[model samples]
Each structure stands twice: as structure tokens, then as C-alpha cells.
Target: MSARVTMKDIAAELGVSINTVHKALTGKAGVSESVRAKVNDKAEEMGYHRNTSASSLRRKDINLVFCLPCASREGAYFYRYLWEGCNRFEQEVIDQGISIERVEFVVGGYADALEHIDERLQVGEKIDGLLAYVPGDDRATHLLEQIAEAGVAIELVDGDRPHFDRLGASLADYSTAGSLMAEQAANLVHASGADARVLLLAGDPYTDSHYLTARAFHNYLRDHNVPWQVEDLTGAHAQVKQLERELKARLSSSEAPELICSVFAVGSELVADTLVSANKAGEVMVIGNDLFPESALALRRGIFTNIVYKDPVGLAYRGAKTLGDYLLWGKTPADPVQKGAVEMVFASNVDRYCKLAGI
Candidate 1:
């Protein structure tokens, strides 16, 4: 099937900037009459369907609130990228009569943040749309319901609560990531032609992403008939010191796994550091998740075998844009869950990813 035509596609075909094409098509005053005619003619030739609903909405002001974890929180490495993406999107749409206000809370403080949002709504604050990384907790669910009932459109990012009637969601496909990591691990084990035990540093089981990743990893190995015993080191990502201690203990034990896998960015560096300290850096194969300064360095140093790169920045940007489009153009995402792209990073290509990630 042919894809829907977009302003970008039109601009590319006409050798013009997207902004110019947008102005011309939208009948904005900046575009010259000649250029507007050309654009309109090309749009018609290309079967562009103008959205009358969106045209009306573009004249209205939009106010959106972004609720997320603060960068100051420990183990917030991933959230930092999310913030960057959100800010980038904000800057891109700054001149479009759209206002994005950020509301940051400490990690694991969703209830507090939701309560604050509820209070603001009660005080007659005008919120056209809201984007948040809401977890599946009762208090969060209750507050989210209240906010939705208050006529505020909501879009979830990073995680999702399926029961909630949200506009849409932008989430990482952690199950696919986990399965990819498992395949990499199995390939490495097969290449060595030796039986090896695997340890999965699975972050909090309650979190949907973490739980799905861990389950997929285990299931993949089992389904493939891989002869590897998988063990889990389960805990919240924020408990850095505790996780480190537990990992260190396992590394020093008699039944220490030969392969270590981390499905999240939180403790990937810890895993590499512990392996280096225990003099098992190159001896044991390590599969990490996400690409940042630390993990990139670990990959370059041969301490990490591979990294399942979950593009958090892209996820956040897409999520914010999804909500923005819904508010400004009356457009809805085709799917309820929009999964961001994932990549596999190795030493040979880690530098390229690092540069792309602005690390």
C-alpha cells in the first residue's frame, strides 16, 4: 500500500523547506502567492487531503504538561535522554502557539506528582493535554482517571497502563529487546561451544517494561532449547548500592554465571565495573542495554559484548509529538501503543551510536 503523503514528502519533491511548504499549504502570510500556488498545485497533484479540522485547531492555543522523573534522581540515566528529547520537540514547536510545561518528580514518586497535578486541576488550571510516564499503581490510576475525567487529554510515555483510556502511548519494545539480547547471548555461547550459566539483571518486576524483558529473555532461551541455566537478580533500578552488592556477591560465589545480561541501563555499568574488579572482564561475555557514555565506553573496552540500544530520546520525542499532533491537528495515532525502534550496538559501531545519542 502507498504511504500517506506528508509535508516533508511534498517539500522534498519541490526542493523547498518544510516550513515553507507548511506556510504555503496552510495559507499563512509569510509564503509568497507564487510559491503558495505552486505548493497548492503540487499538493493537489499528489492527492494531498487537507484536514479542515486540523486547520481550525491550528488557530487555537494549546497547553501541554509533561510529567516525568527529574534528572537529579539516582539511576535516572534514561530519564535524562527522555528530557532531552522532550526539550528538543518543545523547541521545534515553540513558534506554533503551543506551550509545554514540565513537571518533574523524584523517581518512584508518581503518586506525589499525580496528587500535585490533581491539586492544580482543582485550582482551575487550564491543561489541554498531559504526557506522563505513569506506572501501574492504584494511586496513580485513580489520579489519572480523575485527570482524564476533567477533560484533559492524556498520552503515556516510556510505560503504559492499558486499562486507562489514554490518547496513545510511546513505549520501548522491551520484549523484543530482551529476545534480541538472548539471541546474542546464545550465539556467543554457541561460538564458544561450551555450556554457560546466564545471569539476568532484571530490574523491578512490577514495571511492565522490565517484567516483559525478563520474561522474553527466559522464554527465548527455553524455546530455542539452549542449554543455559538462567538466573535472575531482581530489584528496582533505583536501589543502586543494593544491586551492586548483590551482583558482587554473585560474581564471587561458586555458582557464578559465565554470562551476565542487563536489560536496563540502570546497572549495566555496575555489571561491567564489577566484572572488571573481579578480573572477569574479557573472560565472561556481557550483554548490556542502552547506549550512553558509560556503556559505550564499556563496549569499546571489550567489557560489554553487545548492547540492546533502546532509543529513549526518540521515544520521548515521538510521544510528545503524538500528543501535540492530537491537540493541534485533531489527529490520533493509528495504534494505541507506538513502539520506538531498537538497535543492537557492538564495539565496531558503538562510536557511531554514541555520537548520534550526543554522548
Candidate 2:
């Protein structure tokens, strides 16, 4: 590493007083624009402005709250990775005197999260920043606005719901992922020498991620001149049996679908099970999203054409680090909207996702 460049060194290089350098760097009134510009340019050239971490240590330790969904067995594997990233980030900044508190939305939706924050406020707790999975809708928006009013910076994980410029987020490009899945499904249909009618199983209605992905997938199929129909399974997450019956009914037609694409991991698993039970696993092409362990196993078993893998762990890690940057040093991400990387997993590379899940 290069020797640490100090404000003193900047002042020396510019042949000015240290006070002038400080004022210029800090946007104070004492320095004239010409001299200020000179000092600023010299400081930039000399790499002198990264004392923020040390400065953070001089201030009070940061207090942040991480809010996320915690359900029974549903979405548990995904949340495990999100928690892993949060825990690892917590350890990374422990020496810097950063404390992260976790608050789970255990029983319900954003309303439960709102109650958690409200309870914190009731106890006179001060939240410096919040790193959470804020849903993309009015309820979450209204609640997040309330939290913003309470003077807490918000960082979104996996999805951006509020559409606020100041809100920090690290998520994946599900739109592109949707198109990729569509492409795979279309190719499978073409290879089968069958008509391109498909069953598109969508996600929860309240989830903008699912809606966005489903829309993109449908658009891609339409643009490619493929025929498909969508059924929004909003209650599938909570009504597993109902979802099963509905899926069975849909796939029970005399003219079997040549392809099936689902926006959610669970949706894909259900389709796989239904197809196997109906003795159509080899007859239909099933394309699914996410790297849930079951989905990975299915991909390896060739029940799935390919599983779209979005790095949720990476999203949580970056989201935590971004919140840390803002809370500890008053820094914001260069791009307020951060997106996660997406990949495709099949039999050839299902092992990578298995190791990621530690299964």
C-alpha cells in the first residue's frame, strides 16, 4: 500500500496552509474557489480523502437493525443464506464497533415489520439505519416512509419497493432472468417438435418481484412468437394444498402442455411433482427459477431443464456492507440501485449451488 496521504501533505503540495486545505476539503467558506479547486484537485491526485473509516471510529458506535422475513419451513433455505451474509458482515465490522440487531417478520407481512419498528420506537430506541427486505408496494412504502420520518436510513435487500432515490438497495435483475428462463423453455419446445403452448405459473400477487418476472417472461415469449398462458398463484405460498390441486387441474388436460415455466422455486417443485405423479415428467419440459436445494436436485436429475440462480447471499452481503458504509461513515453507494448477479445451473454445474447451500 502507498504511504497514507495526509491533509498536511496536500497543503504542502499546494504550498498553502493546512487550515486552507481542511476548509477546501470540507467545503467551508474560508477558501476561495480558485485555491479551493487547487487544493481539492491536489487532494484527489494524492489519494488523501479516505480517513473516513478512522473518523468513524472517533464517533459513537453505529446502531443498525436488520429486518427480514422468518417463516416456518417456507423460504427457510433462502433466508438462511441471507442470514449468513448478515452474520458474516457483522463479524467483519465488529472491531469497528458496529452493532447490528435483527428483527424478523415472523408471523405476517410488512405490517408485522411495522409493529416491530413501532415497538422499538415506543421504547425510545434510536435506529441509525435499517437493512431489510422492504416489499415493493404501497403498504411497505407507507411503513418505510414512517421509518424514514423517524430518522433511519433504509437499505433494501433483493428488491426495491419504495422507488426512493435515497434508498439503498442490492438486488438481482429478475426481468432478465425471466427472459432467460423463457428462452430455455422456448428452445425445449422447439426441440420437442410440438406446438409451443405452455403453462406459466406466476408468484404471489403482493410480490412485485414475481409480477415483474412474470411480465418479462410473458413478453419474451410473445416477442419470440411462442404461445403461453399465465396463472397467478398468489396464495400458493400459504395454501400449499390448494396450489397442488390447482396445478393438478391445470395439467390434467387431454392435450398435455409441451412446456411449463414457473417464477418461483416452489412453483417449479410443484410442477415437477405433478408431472411425475401424472407420468408426464419425461413428456414435458419444465424450467424453473432459483437454486433451492430441491430445485438443484431436480436439475441434476433432469427433471428441470435449468435452474436460474440469483445470488441471494451476495445481495445480503452487499446490502449489509452498504448499510454499514452509510451508518458508520455517512457514505452512500455510488449507485443507489444495486443489483445481484444471476446464473443458470444444470446437471453439469448443480454441485456449485449444492455447496453454496452447504447441502
Alpha-carbon shift of residue 149 in model 1 (angstroms): 0.9
RMSD of 2: 8.9
Best by lDDT: 1
Model 2, position 188: C-alpha lDDT score: 76
Q: Estimate each model's TM-score.
A: 0.82, 0.79
lDDT of 2 at 38: 92
lDDT of the candidates, in the order given: 0.83, 0.74
Q: Give the per-residue lDDT of model 2 (tens digit) for 91-127.
A: 8998887777887775357666776786686587877
Off by over 4 Å in 1: 1-55, 73-76
Candidate 2, poorest ten consecutive residues by summed lDDT: 227-236
